[model samples]
Target: MSLELYYWDGLQGRGEFVRLALEEARADYVEVVRGKSSEGLGTAAMMALMKSRDEPYPPFAPPFLKDGDLVIAQTANILFYLSPRLNLAPSVESLRYVANGLQLTIADMVTEAHDTHHPLASGLNYEDQKDAAKLRAHDFIDHRIPKFMSYFERVLKQNPAGDTFMVGDALSYVDLSMFQLIDGLLYAFPRALKRFGEHYPRLAALHDAVLVRPNIAAYLESGRRIEHNEACVFRHYPELDKAAT
Candidate 1:
């Protein structure tokens, strides 16, 4: 049976990470909440499932995958589970651990990216948190970006198999996640990313390479690829951008 991915109907959000892996692997799966519904199963449906008693393995949030009798949540954890099955992970135990470590790093960067606009509180509107957002955005541009980029660049440069992929010679889930990270950063912080790109040539190349992958290219061209917006994690507020500059 095909796997069932449950998440908000629109926007990539966290779900896109899992979706990208599935697409890259050419795995058969259905985007559950995105399917036809009278009321439309979006965030509400996702929330209900998380809180439902019927669910033996409730997710902490959206972007959970149900494969047969198993349910898995947490973006990195989902990737951890799917990576081996999809042959998008290293075979060696140490390399697999390294891949997951990189994934966690990506998660940290993503959270920081979201905080750039919602530093005060995610519940508050960007308009309401503009001052805090400015502070956070500046910090991110000045410190966080370089820090994360340096780490990933080191991983690539220090990899035993060379700089082609995150974990050794072959493409892995971490590479795809890194691709998404760079792509989202570029969208959310064009100027900052441009400046940051000069320091991490290999990372930029990986981002470009992932986009050229057949499945990823199709996903990008298709309506499935949601554009970054104010409602999502990586919001582009002019004030935040200006602060970064």
Candidate 2:
């Protein structure tokens, strides 16, 4: 059966991470909400499923996955569930947990990235929270970016197998997520990421490697890959970006 991925239409948002894995694995899946409304696979259908009382446990938001009879929510949880099935996870059981931990950490960074533009509140517009966002973005670019990215650099450098992949000897979902994370960061803060190659060489290399992977390259060139926009989690605001020292 084709996996049904439920996420908002237009923007990549948190759903892109899941989409990356699915694309990399060449998994048979359908973007439920992206489908035509005429076919009853649009946002209305997605909302109906969410509101359906027949479901034992409904997701709090979109970016959930429906695999066979199982409904999986939360980006991290969705990736964890799909990774093994997609052959994008480590064969070692213990390393799978490690990959999950890394993915969760990546999620944390993603939240921080979103908060940088909407520091005061998600309810408020970025223009309304511009002042606070500037402050938050400064701290994030100066401290958090280095902290989280440095840890990933260390993870790659210290990988038991090699620096090619995140959790194991081969490509894993964590590596795919890392690529998206770095790519998003670069889009949102090009100035801040200017020194990425110098400071986070391993991570930068990994990002480059993932970019050239045949499946990923094709997906990127295809119209299916949504461009980063203000509505997405990683928004580019010139005033909110600062170059690293």
Candidate 3:
């Protein structure tokens, strides 16, 4: 059965992380809400499912994946469920748990990235919280980025497989999530990232390497790879971004 991913149409948002794994695995999946009304599976269909009582437990939001009778939500949870099934994690049972741990940390980094621009309230616009955002962004560039990058760089160096992949010796879903996280940071803080890259060479290499993978490279060129914009999690606001160095 084809996997059904319920996420907003034309917006990557948190859904891109799930999409990356699916695309990398070449899994047969449909972006449910990306469809049109003529097909009876569009954004409206996704919203309906969210409120529907058909399922014993409905997701609080989009980006949930429905596979046969099982449905999973939460980015890390969805990836954890899909990783083993899609062959995007290490075959070793223990290594899959390690991959999930890395993914959960990556999710924390992603939340910090989003919070930088909306430190006060998600309901308020960036402009409304510009002061708080500047403070948050500054701290993120100086503290959070270095902290996260250092940990991941250390993971790469310590990996028994080598510094190429996040877990074990292969391209796990964690690596894909790392690539997406770096891509967003670069877009959101190009100058800041350029200044900080020298401290994490292996991490940078992993990000670049993932971009060239056959499936991923094609996805980048395809319409599925939505460009980062103001509406997305990683938004670029010039004043809120700066180089720590």
After superposition, candidate 1 runs with Cα above 4 Å error:
38-45, 242-245
Best by TM-score: 2
Ranking by TM-score: 2, 3, 1
Better of 2 and 3 by TM-score: 2
Error of 2 at 63 (Å): 0.4
What ranking emerges by lDDT with the best candidate at the front? 2, 3, 1
Task: Report how far off residue 104 is in candidate 2 (Å).
Answer: 0.2
Whole-model Cα lDDT per candidate?
A: 0.85, 0.94, 0.89
- Overall local distance difference test of candidate 1: 0.85
Comparing 1 with 3 on lDDT, the higher-scoring candidate is 3
Write model 2 residue lDDT over 1-245, tens digit each, in one string. Answer: 89999999899899999999999999999999989989989999999989998888989898999988889999999998888889998999999899999999999999999999998889988899899999999999999999999999999999999998998899999999999999999999999999999999999999999999999999999999999998999999989898986
The RMSD (Cα, Å) of candidate 1 is 1.9
List runs of model 3 lying over 4 Å from the truth.
Answer: none
Worst 10 residues of 1 by lDDT: 236-245
For model 2, the local distance difference test gives: 0.94
Superposed on all Cα atoms, the candidates' RMSDs to the truth, in angstroms, are 1.9, 0.9, 1.2
